[model samples]
Target: MASPGIFSEVRDPSERVRQLCNYACKVDIDEAIPPKRYLRSGLEMMRMAKVYQEEGNYESAFILYTKFISLFVEKLPKHPDFKTAPQADVSAIKKKVVASFASAEKIKAKLKERYTAIEKKRQEEEKRIQEELARKQAEEEARRKEIEELEECKRQEAETKWLEEQEARLQELKRQEVERQRQQEAAAAAAVAAAAAGINSGAPPNFLNNQIPSAPPGNLSYIPNDFGGSTKLVDIDSQPAGTGPIIPDRDLKKNLLINDGPSVSSPLPSVDRTTKPPAYDHFMSTGSSSGNKFGLRDVIIPSDLPRKFLVKAEHNTLKNIETCGILAGKLRHDAFVITHLILPKQSGTSDTCVAEDEEDLFLYQEPRDLITLGWIHTHPSQTAFLSSVDMHNQYGYQAMLPEAIAIVCSPKFNETGIFSLSIERGLVEIGSCRQKGFHQHNKTPPLFEDSSHAKTVDTEKIEVADLR
Candidate 1:
């Protein structure tokens, strides 16, 4: 360290202190503030360092920089009181430190270029002000020009619209003329085909045709099966034992399966009025040309279902929660009997849940030899609607058994709704939809077991057996 030559020479204490720092630390200060204290404000140290470096005194600048780095940039953050200081303030100090660390020659060039930059900015500001004044004057000139252009554009638009209207009218008339000619040609072709058929059958085509006129709109109670086509109803009991398999009626949509013998003479099947056969729900499908699709045409719950299961579901419903139970039983005669109601273990909130112990529940059913028919659950709201999760679960059940159904009981609304995937529309849509969680479905599917037809099992025949 250099010796302080001002060893009691200056009368003012501030001046003496400045001399001491200048001599000992190679730093000069305008005031007598301590070097360490000045460096405490990192920005102040940076300004002092720049001043020293620009003035060709590199030693003082580097010393001040070393003090600034040690005190503010690094050590201050580790102190408990300053640990939580603003990050932005710390970053600003860092940037200044980086700028001050430049070489002496680099610092001189940057400082000299700064004055030139300020002058350039002043000139730019003056130029911008002049351009704004010029633009205000030009706006008046453009006003008249814009009005002339606008008038010319309006005239062009009017002319274009008139031409378009005329073209559209001509095209419509041409289409009507083409349609008139097509209808006349079709009538002539039909007349020729009818006359040829009359000659071949030796009778008028309309007379030989067994087609009946459709009923008036007021008389349409139910659409006769096969759209009013004359059909000889075929009953299974009426078929003779030794005869070949019953030939399916044409509109039955069954495959053209021929028997192993010679062809039959009459295509008409025998009809028996005494048979009380089950009525089946049917639809016309065209996606597949051969084979008819059948679902459980209708499901009839006895007017006497056990009340215990309903009692439990009603309890959960009142509390605005949910509960699920399974309906399983043996296939008695031609229908399913609800002999058991097993409430399985599950975890869910008011909206959704997963049924666990399904494998075990199903395994137990295997020993009892009962078929898993359908499932029933209660909703807090009376809407009795299926959420997207409900649909996915139904998809698995429906896939396993085509006749499987979903029953939703909304005790709040006193609503019980039954739903099934429409083999044509419902099953195809639900089976194809792979989305999960709450999602949108197109429409409510047709139900094989509707709430309106959910007959209560007679109390006399009702019995409760919990297999939970």
Candidate 2:
């Protein structure tokens, strides 16, 4: 509460002034409550304005100093005791109020500069973040476009293969129709001959008893038993000579070397169905069954193609760590050969793990010149072999390109292997496997074949710009 007489009803000019003086002299200037004396109360406010100025509350301090000057200094000369008060004391309070306002203005200037600097820094940081986001978005879009193009190429390849196979089937059907018609015509001619000779038309021809000229192994000719209706693909390779005329539906026969107009005599080499394909990819120009599927030219690799991976593994900080990358190449007229071996940024380890990155610098290096053919990896310490993880990786590669090959090099163990899954066999089985880590799988007919010949190196050297 205020002091006793601060709000009293005393109104005498001299008597009330003495009472007010008594109240002013007894009031504590430093107390939390305001003093009854305006002089001391205004002086205390001037000190508080200095504190507010240094604390960066410039506006608040300026307002307080303004109120002190208007209420106290404007009324200083009106005070009855002004002549008795020290002139230095009055000057000191005026100087202090002026200093407080000046300091508040200085703080305002500093705050303006500080705020401007903060805003500029914030804008720069925001721009940097936006730029980073744009970069990542562009790289992601590029990778997505690459994946779409690869998928489209695979779709076209599959469609072409399907069309070729359909054409082959249609050709086979036409050959069968021709073969059947030839038998019917031959039967009709035999019937005419028999009837003209005064013999039964339905009876078997006498030529059936006499030995006829044997047809070629592939283009076998047959005369039906008087009535010709149905036809069958003949497997003359399995049939013996003395048992009957051997009929063949082998590739040579399916090629339809038949007597559409006149019969041609061409010898056919015997084929062994049990023979397996070569351990490595090589030109199969024998024109045999194997040549029908793998007719493309043989893939070739140079001896020093993998020197970069070896050198990189040796010089990097983690000497014993595993390394992996994509083998990029292109398809020529007859062969698919490696033109660039891209070392994409990845998280590799001693035995396993090759994490993929969508924004990898290598993804943009190929542009329109290269194609991702397969994968390559180093085992650091272990001998070369496809682990379960390797199987999963190569499965994706082979799906994109049938001729995709896997290369496993062990720099420390001095081992290297180039291989591909045998048919849609082990790799196919492994693709659907639920197990993780290394494990065994039971597969027949062998799982893989050596594909070392498919690799080759170009004169172009590895560029740091490409790996960045």
Candidate 3:
């Protein structure tokens, strides 16, 4: 559909006014109008325009002012009554039209100033939000870097301490080796001195009485002697006090071999176990055991919801007109709970109801942090089921929240039911179907069904706002 006017969305007030004037000049006016009727209509229109201006409705006032000036200044000159009117009346009308034109100019300037200020404030707000986000991201990055540096420092310190311990072990092993060799050399010299004394005294060599000193107390290994089949102790070291028996040389070397790479001392990355997947908790709740496996949380409705909505729609029901209301609520304890029913300003027929001024509805819900769970509408004379229009509307709600449900009240039929699209088939079919208004769908696999995830609770009260 075309716009109501060519200048409707134009941002520049002067340009918009120029376009409107051009369009108005082309509009045909009734030439048979009486002078008194014209004057009366102009007075009423000007009065209304002043009222709109005083109420801070500058756009409406500007449009009215423009229309008034256009009719009097552009079209009135062609009117037969305007030509034959008294000279004084014509001059008065001309003066008023000129005054109205001036008023329109002032209104246009005011509108431009108002819109410019609004745009400036909006831009500033957006800039502030972007700066805040950037500041937070910078702080987070700094923190992440600090954590990494701290972990690196700790890992390096651990590796350095390990190297120092290994160095100390090597020094102790070298000292023990030197002590063992010195003891062996002293024992061998004493044995040779005793044998020389025995030869000088001419007595039988008392090798058994002056025996050589035993080597060490640790696990011993012997080497073959050149003199016959006898064996002699080679290198050995005593066990350190209080430590378990010394490891053998071969086993000790194997244990001391460095690994292929340094062992890392950094901790494993932290996991946020508290964070739950967006909507999984709802379907995984104990109450949602019977629903389809789409993992949507159960929705709790007030038991008195149907009765309260019916009472709100009583006037429309009696007149055989449909009444619709938005269902709004909050998520609590892993479930969506209906807390408010908002009836927006609307017009309805027997089978259709359209809520208007939806921005007003958003304004009302925003401050309270309300979620649009779904909607409730009366069927009036029809049965309690969703029409094609309702299906499309519900699609939007469900898209916002998979568990959203539509409630239909049929006062004449004494029926009330809560419903949702069949996730397995209905949601897809209705989402893809483009036909608007009341229409038919395949009944073989029903397009909608009773919502298994929604149940009524009598424990809480549901608030109502009749914006109408």
Choose the strongest candidate by lDDT.
3
In model 1, the clashing pairs are: 302-456, 302-457, 303-456, 303-457, 303-458, 304-456, 304-457, 304-458, 305-457
Q: Each candidate's TM vs. the true structure? A: 0.35, 0.35, 0.39
| Predicted model with the maximum TM-score | 3
Q: Please give the range of 10 consecutive residues that has the lowest summed lDDT in model 2.
A: 281-290
Q: What do the candidate models score in CA lDDT, each in turn?
A: 0.50, 0.52, 0.67
Per-residue lDDT tens digits of candidate 2, residues 1-468? 111112123333334334322322231111211222344334445544554555554433444555555444454455556666556556666786677556645644654454455456767987997797778778777776776676666666665555455446546655765676588668666766655574555554465544344442343445343314233344433565533233222233223222222222333444533322223321111111123235323344545656766776564424667777666654443345566666766776777746466346333632434555577788887888887678766765554344678888877668878877655476558556667677777645656667633645564344322251
lDDT of candidate 3 at residue 7, scale 0 to 100 = 37
TM-score of 1: 0.35
Give me the runs in candidate 2 sitting further than 4 Å from their true place. 1-297, 316-318, 361-366, 443-445, 452-468
Model 1: per-residue Cα lDDT over 176-229, one tens digit each: 445654665666567667767788989766634533333212211122334443
Please list the residue runs of candidate 3 whose C-alpha ends up more than 4 Å from where it truly belongs after superposition: 1-292
